[model samples]
Target: MTRIKNLADLHKIKEEVQSKNRLRSSLDYPEHLVQIKVGMATCGIASGAKETMKYLNDELEQQAIDAVVTKTGCLGYCYAEPTIEVTLPGKEPVVFGYVDKAKVVEIIDVYIKRGEQVEGIIPLNFQTIDD
Candidate 1:
């Protein structure tokens, strides 16, 4: 981590973090924004879900994508730890497994940006209450 050499530098870092948090937690008209749910359960964390979540959050902001990246529970896909469920506006949510840095980039570029499908998607067999 970079050392905070002065109070101004510390404030700058804090503001940066706050900006990212606001973007990730934004819920206004959520139906119009891309919704990314990262599995953060124990199994998921063990598989490096924290890194996955951080990368997703940072990349989305850097790309200026209007998205909300939130954390969820197990998602019932223990075999596919570090999984993420992405819901594009006006579409059904799709869960992808084994998400790493490269997968996150592909997901943002191909799936999220261009609305194209990528591999590693875990087919949803169960329906949610909303369905």
Candidate 2:
């Protein structure tokens, strides 16, 4: 926890809290907002998931994009650590693998903003045990 040493610190805390609140409220209508889930398991962290998650959050804020970014356990893609699942409004979620900083920028600009697909997309696995 960070100590509130001054008015500026307090204001910063307030802004952070407000931002979190807004993000929570946005979940009420998630279908209208962009949703992102970052894998943060051991494999993911080892592959720099922390940095990827931070970049996504910061970039979204800088672009003033309304998004709900959350962290999750292993997405079952250990080979593709640091993976992210992005869901656009009214669209199916797409999971991308091996996401570095440059890939993040490309995803934001091309996929998220322009609705265009980018490389490195991991095709969703659909086979069931019952099969």
Q: Residue by residue across 39-93, what tens digits does model 2's lDDT show?
A: 9999999999999999999999999998889999997999988899998766778
Per-residue lDDT for 41-98 in model 1, tens only?
A: 9999999999999999999999899887889999889998899999886677899999
- Candidate 2 regions with alpha-carbon error over 4 angstroms: 1-31, 127-131
Candidate 1 error regions (>4 Å):
1-31, 128-131
Per-structure clash totals for the candidates: 0, 0
Q: lDDT (CA) for every model shown?
A: 0.88, 0.88
lDDT of 1 at 66: 83
